[model samples]
Target: MKFSTAAIMAFPAALLLAWQAAAAPGQGPDAETRAWWTITEALSNDRMEGRDTGSAGYDRAAQLVADKFKAAGLKPLGDKGSWFQPVAMNEIAIERAGIGVGDRPLVFLQDITVDPSNAMPVTVDAPLAYRGYCGAAALGDVRGKIVICHGVNRPGLPGAAERIAAVKAAGGIGLATIADPGFAIEPPRWPFAYARSVTLANASPDTDGFLRLRLKADALKKAIGDHGPDAGDLIAKGSAGEPLPGFDIRESFHATFTVKRRQITSSNVIGLLPGSDPASTDQAIVLSAHLDGYGFGTPVNGDGLYNGTLDDAAYVALLIRVAEQRRGKGYRRPVIFAAFTGEEKGLLGSTWFVAHPTLPRTSIAANINLDQLRPIFPLDLLTVHALDDTSLGDDVRAVANGMNIAVQHDPEPARNLLRRSDQWPFLQAGIPATAFVFGYRPGTESERIYRQWYRTGYHTPLDDPHQHIDWKAAADFNRFFKTLVERVADQEAAPAWKAGSSLRPAGH
Candidate 1:
């Protein structure tokens, strides 16, 4: 269904006016912030159904953004000169699964979660081994065994990929990683809405048949009852990144799985704001935010919709606001506004965009991605990812310092957050990029608010518009973003990879 510009603007315009009227003379969000919220509310309201990738809800949201882009006087830069680049995807989910140790069964999604795969075996009854961190040295001759390892998300510790490779090479059929309890910055959240994975439709499924699973720290005792080292002691050692004993469980592990698979199509909404200066028109600055959310999921407090207000709806709205603000006059460098899909699934959309950009890949100057940002507290500081990798960091620091906002490199690198968002794909492609998080000092009220939001609102229904917001913080970040973009887009030199940066491609 197509919507006229008038029809599309009608609802949001009314919402903006209502929000403005309700604002106390001087007590609420500023006018610009109110406008930003109006767009956010329109995209994140229950009516949009959380904008799940490839769903009608997402399509509706995409069309709305395209309409806004058209009204903003931006030129469509998607496939076939339209405002969207269609991306084909394959989604897989676990319908039901059971995992057990001896006669004890672990709860699905509560005690354990498995990665869904088309190549998953129907049943496996194999000897179990506790291989500590599953490092190559600890993994003994475990032919046809399921290995359990401590899941540590920090540098210098064996991570998931390395552990999986070691186990697979050692002929292990499965791996269960015990969730780390010591990572206080971002502790694990349980009862995940569901276990789902999405990949580009053209990508081949893994045929290796190795099972991947995550075990709750509290459930470790039950899973290894009377078979291996004491669960409590092992967890303590692993959490502290200490060496641990590797031993075989006396009892065999059993598992059965049922998976559902389907193919779907989603799109990235793209628009081009042509540079006013013809000399710099070929160099485009890409501004991006993901539009996909969890959609409906296992109910938390009887509300299943993951509205994703700040997880990204708010940032997408911010992109639209930027387009609207510069409708008639674009920056010196062309700006590509991309509302990407399938970020929640795994950065699929941006990956696709980088591989198949609407414009020449060489012309993309830099990307300033907006995700993983929360304005629940004052924006006293900003944590910039890739802060040392490229000149973009210098641009951010200059703009932020003017606003009295301290800029710092990622404080929590163990989270592996730098590789977790849309900006990652661009960086991998040798395009200088950066993303941000509102920073806080340790043990402060600001830190408490930031942590609390991740605990309750990060990916849950609690991320809706009704949640408390720091109006000043929201407005301040918006201003900072606007200024940063102008500075980067108007600057004479294109962003460059810093010397000695590992991410810089040859000749870049």
Candidate 2:
């Protein structure tokens, strides 16, 4: 979802001209481009209804991809000889929540936004300890206290989840985080009508239950009395990325949360192209992309549907194109094409797939996940997630180099993108995995366009097929991705984690 721009300008003038020439509409694209467009356009069409996870729209989209897999002669690798691996999910919608300090009641979403994570019901009344930013230095005496943290977390430091994990480890009863308005990627501090959590009905809670919320500055200021550094000052300082100190707020906070739950199931479309070589046939190269989008959300530009055309549907189309192009042919290792559901919902589908694989867990050799390939600009560079963690990174570089596209490491690690996508589960399971985003160097038109897409179209109705797409760039990327798959599948050795990789499993 980010880029680097100066590397783009380094391309030769003739290369730019050729790229422009290839993008012209009347020139007509070849079969791969046409196929990719046809599938992407169809998936993003109104008929698909944004393909929200666990919705009928998503079911229809899954069937559509399954039909394509069938047509391409890919064998079903899903449940009960069908083309879908069903995943059970529990949807939790917050009904109501409240917070209070002394006589002042903090209004929901306006005065604060609470975390909807429901391991068990949450109710807490505890003394507040103002733990500045949740940094190590600020966490000294938070045991059994309600810790107040400024901002989600410091940049280049632990994220909200990680900080909360530390808090739980420190025996904190609850946490309240102040949001920073300065970060462009931060979502608005609006009330969430509902939230989702994995339905691990049989498992015990991972940690002791706690109250977590993001408090508005005004509300916190009122709650803390006429305190040192009013809420506004604290928020402003946090916004400017300044360090804060811990102190006892000398107030008791009360919170209560409630949620309703319903069980739902989503399906991941799984198909496999069998390997020809006996030695490698048992191993599988998994190609993945999410098949779900926002579905319906707060309306954007007068439209409610978040048709994820380039955010994914396009990459799913690329998967189908690979199936088509590889028809009547075979790789050395089996190639598994998986269009996962619930990527927009905490990578649920892929997580389920890894936990309950259609094939043996040991058979998965590697994962190459695709998502949000913005071809609005030229495809001069590619960003490979986890670029330094596995040999799959080397494979990606070789493929990109062969296609004359520069390969770049992720430019925005703060996004935590490597752990955000479907590839993450595979990596966590000790499989070498990677995901890609189109790259642009800093200070280029490519960077501007890329930023513009995220700001305006990302998760919005503007992401529909009607949006402009550099078809030639799409074609180029599809080709490069297809070759990358081929190279991985044909390689003599299965993909491997690099030594000293933090993601590497013990003794791997």
Candidate 3:
């Protein structure tokens, strides 16, 4: 698969000037700095366990945020007349299970992590065929075949599934996604899965004829090779050629898991900054960031909370700041400041929010989502993803150009960061949305910083509120954000998608 290099365009000199620019009339986020830190600290405190959506801990966090909004004198746009916008949700936490090739069992949690997806009558005698990542073309056929692919494949092979897909396109079916899945989200890689069943699955889906391979190390290495720089560092994937040893048990490889499905409740904390104009109040610009994190993974500083400090904890703070700014401005359009939950569980929070919207969907002009941000990135430039087909992309570009920061589109399409964040729900609803993430690696030092973050901090209990932030960078970003919103909000017309653009709202 071809990869798009991340576009890192520099800002015009004027953008740099804005950092030190005179307040153009009114050019600063309201002086709610204390409020910013309080919200950030509270939601990310060790007690919350990373605020896993639907958890009691997250409920407490939500109540606190709503209280803060109420204290700020903001109103709820929700139907029920309260600032708290309840986002209905279904939460599933797969207990544990066992999978084995023979009498010898494959490691669980270590060598594999399976999603108790669905139940199949414990059948005996399954066949063999290992599919590739890209599917068929590079891998081979695997229909009614027991396939063995890597958890993470590497070099000299297109990856069994990629080959399998190629073959599938040429006519192939019944595939499985295997990879050495990890549980950390520090530097934030892929989610750990015994099998990558679907691009995105809803609730308890089928799991018969489908299986994710979590193989034994010896077999794994032969299948995937050492995961070194030479492995899949730059290109290729986990999957290689290995004939299935004519090994078959008269009965099927029986696997049992204590999978329980439960309906969980989480929320989207929404507060409205109603605009001065009643006509526009019905429509609004939404600011969103997920508030959930992988709670209870590794311990951080003796604290057990998966406090999503930077993942979205920071963005949540930013959302409040924006709300404060809009309320103060006596703005002309309703601005929805939403804190989403269940992002770690597949954008569930945002999905729930959109599906059970407090306001009409058509009135939602656009969404500005903040997933993760760091101080090191040059604050002078504004980086956004999913720029294609939206006028907002141009609005951002124009503002970036006017501000002098070069705008950029995502270089990596395969990653599909667009569909991955909270922005997708609105995007799917036909309203245009975009997200901002802080990412740029100039050299080894930067790489080291991100690496250490992933290994030692991300998704761990260690992700705490104690770490100091680059206050200046935070201020600068909020400044740019202020400008971006002012530009969008002040416009006499709502931002539109370019014709034939994939992002255009339905019936546009």
Best-performing candidate as measured by TM-score: 1
Clashes per candidate, residues 3 or more apart or on different chains: 0, 8, 54
Q: TM-score of every model?
A: 0.91, 0.81, 0.75
Query: Candidate 3 residues 185-279, lDDT tens each?
Result: 22222223222111122445554434443443333433333322232321233323332221212323445555555666677788877777877
RMSD of 3: 8.8
Q: Please, what is the whole-model Cα lDDT of each candidate in the order they appear?
A: 0.87, 0.77, 0.58
Candidate 2, residues 254-279, lDDT tens digits: the string is 77777777778889999999998998
Off by over 4 Å in 1: 1-27, 154-156, 226-229
Write the number of the candidate with greater TM-score, choosing between 1 and 2: 1
Candidate 1 accuracy as TM-score: 0.91
Q: What is the lDDT of residue 19 in candidate 3?
A: 33
Q: RMSD, each candidate, Å? A: 8.1, 6.4, 8.8
List the candidates ranked by lDDT, beginning with the highest. Answer: 1, 2, 3
